[model samples]
Target: MNNKNINRETIIKFNPSQLVNLPVFLLGMILIPGLCLLDDLIKLYLPSGFIPEEIELYIRNLPVYLALLYAIYLGYQILKISCIRYEISPEEFRYYSGILSRKHEFIENYRVKDFSINRPLIYRLFGLGNLTIYTSDKTTPVFKMEAISNPQDIYKTLRGLVEQNRRAKHVFEVD
Candidate 1:
């Protein structure tokens, strides 16, 4: 008999959606191919035997170099997003983020002291904010989630869970 029953269900799971804008992604996809086509059109219209062989070779290969550079940059962007993940469960909040190396951190709900949402001007324009979690945990005292949509809702949900967990654990903050 094999039993894989996970007791806890995820309350919320999210990535950095606000950081990956559809228009920006589409623009990047179009820019390279458009530039290559423009290079081809320029070569076609040029006067007969005007550009020297070395210069022509360099010009013809310029698009390939540009494409390679863009590919490397885009790869980094994809990896940056792929490497970060945030999960909220009833008992704990988890953060996973790294590239080539991996770091996973969990803060129990009872340890969470306070959390706040900060929306800079640009993030406000995009309807996104950063969630900052302050915990009593020694390893990661402050954890931040950037470019998350509707962070206030998440903060309220998290605050409720924290209170519930603290009650269950019989932990009370004394001032």
Candidate 2:
């Protein structure tokens, strides 16, 4: 008999930490073979033997180089995802992120009004979402979380706090 239950804290991500595009990867895979086909086609078409065969060969090989360059570009684009981490405590919710330069933001619990989820078609298809937060403070963000995962849960949690603050009448960020 085996019975196991592990209790873990709720980890919320308002955005995706990594990028994934199966189609782009697949396109690169297909392009690898297509380069050879295109090179052969160019070789067959560059007629008359007037130009040096070496020059023709170089021209024919250009597609392979182009395909390799495009693959590199795709890799760079897909690698642009930045990680977002949020820690929600009784006092404040803190957000932190940086692929290079670290940035941190803290929002007091009481000033929060509500949070809305934005799931455009691209996000929905790709399993990504954003959280837009409403707060009393004039700070930009109006509270925005991007590329986060499990946004619906974060939205619900933030919304629940609005009513909780209402009952407590707590004032946050007095400055």
Candidate 3:
């Protein structure tokens, strides 16, 4: 593409939805209670002296420990999702990710081979979808934009950009 046609301005920028962590959150909710119940069952069925006091104490506090760990994990999941950012310009797609360290990736628009959108039942309720881009870029052959809003519109815009970029770059896919 000629320098005159280059547009560095970002056309679309988005971060994945926090709702993607729903399953992990639900599992933690169920697991903590289940662990407490199991501890109670063990106490009720076993003789008082059958298990050592230290072991008994550990069993009794297992749920609290697990809950703390789960909380940390959930926080990490939220942070990880928040750190991911995607940007699409007319010429290329940019992906930014990392919690402690930042990583930036780019795929030229002309390199995009195909696109697919997946809207799961849960995601559909929230008007969110996952967009997968199949690209010729070797660094990232398949890129997924998970749990983003208004994916259909983005898909259409990207499809047009890809066509335009390919024509400008004189790139033709044989297959």
Candidate 4:
């Protein structure tokens, strides 16, 4: 047994994928444009004077929904900083998060197999990328490790780590 001195270490890192509250983003993207397009249509039916009753009702309702979605997006963005942290202990690589309730996932190093990178069109244009990790057990999935960032470097780093662990295990078996 070797004391690698790699126990109970914490790495506080945040990534852009965390910002991807897809439903919230989608709501904003869809509704704002939709409302704009509906603007003329809304006006058309809006009794051409001090805003029709139905139009006023519709417009009034939009703010509450939009406000709710915006609040969710804002919360995700703001909460990203406090909750985004990963800890690499001697036995487990753990992920920690929570806005209301704390969350964590701790997996042993030997179980990680492959690391992959993915980039959405916007991220690609911005020169940012994403990282995913596949495991040896095939139970856990390739998760978006670090969100929008330089994908190449992270991919290489994680890949190297997984490979290094596998090689070490292989050497021990041979001995």
Candidate 5:
């Protein structure tokens, strides 16, 4: 492998890029609870006979329930997105995922056949894209990196490393 272009010590590691809807999700996380609290405050100001007691109780409690549901959904998203990570080394591409326990997968650069970067309109707006690597590894024929920034550069680096590794290995195919 060419040692000059590749840096053995400088590993590229990063988490998933923030989604375009991230701000909306975060707003819901705060707004839901605040609205629920406000509902309770409004109830204290209204006269006791403004509505039937049973109906009033349900109406006041609905926001809290909605808030609870939204909280769970938001928490799940945070956990899933935070747990996933990508790492690019000189000779291998690694993907790490899982919440409590971790799962590690490594793909040798030499086995990569080709790769492509997809920058859809929305992803481009957010400075994020999807990178797909087609490889000879049977366990994982196609590895994908989603919601990553600067996918074009990453793809180029990975493609260069794959070429270098293949050349070093003297791998050749007739077909």
Candidate 6:
């Protein structure tokens, strides 16, 4: 019945930070250099005539090729994470994600059962955290908003909105 609760405006809309791929990026950083080094070592240690010229060239270039492939994989990871978006409103929580084919999903605020915030050491360093939402919706029982900034504030807002929506709907969790 409250006028404030009647408004369906979005309280928060955010895309997960590209830093979500930090670990992968770091691993790639290490591996790419190591791979290049391995290629050099192969060229130095292997005898000039130990193998056919074509095979020898392929062996020497293998690491460089792998490094290129890993670089491509890293780009894809960053792009996929960037495409994800989350929206919270008084009535529902919406998630949109996809690279080529888009998908949209939502859970009513009243369906939210619990919430948790995880701040890993790396994420804490950047003031980022993941918010996990437990909902009664069958299709999406567990949802995670990963590597988003200021998760605690968003958690509080969503908790309050979920309580208000539940009260308005007279929804009770019997468990």
Off by over 4 Å in 5: 1-7, 20-60, 173-175
- State the TM-score for model 5: 0.72
Q: Predicted candidate 4: what Cα RMSD to the true structure?
A: 6.2
Residue runs of model 3 more than 4 Å from their true location after superposition: 1-6, 42-56
Model 4, 19-126: lDDT tens per residue? 455555666677777766666565566554587877777675665666666777667766764476654443446677787788777666668766667787766776
C-alpha positional error of residue 60 in candidate 3 after TM-score superposition, expressed in Å:
2.9
State residue 122's C-alpha deviation in candidate 2, in Å. 6.7
By lDDT rank, best first, the candidates go 6, 3, 1, 5, 2, 4
Model 3, poorest ten-residue lDDT window? 1-10
Candidate no. 1 TM-score: 0.68
TM-score of model number 6: 0.88
**Pick by TM-score: 5 or 6, better one:** 6
Put down candidate 1 lDDT per residue, 9-119, tens digits, no spaces: 678877776365545577678987788797888677755468898887877777777777877877777787778888888889888889988889899999999887889
- Which window of ten consecutive residues has the lowest lDDT sum in model 4? 1-10
What is residue 18's positional error in candidate 5, in angstroms?
Answer: 2.0
Give the least accurate 10-residue stretch of model 5, judged by summed lDDT: 1-10
In terms of TM-score, the best-performing candidate is: 6
Ranking by TM-score: 6, 3, 5, 1, 4, 2
Candidate 3 per-residue lDDT, tens place, 121-147, comes to 999999999999999898999999989
lDDT of 3 at 172: 96
TM-score: the better of candidates 1 and 4: 1
- Which segments of candidate 6 are over 4 A away from where they belong? 1-6
Give the Cα lDDT of each candidate: 0.80, 0.65, 0.87, 0.60, 0.78, 0.88
Model 2: which ten-residue window has the lowest total lDDT? Answer: 1-10
- The C-alpha local distance difference test score for the whole of candidate 5 amounts to 0.78
Tell me the spans in candidate 4 whose CA falls farther than 4 Å from its real position. 1-14, 17-26, 29-82, 87-92, 171-175
TM-score per candidate: 0.68, 0.55, 0.85, 0.59, 0.72, 0.88
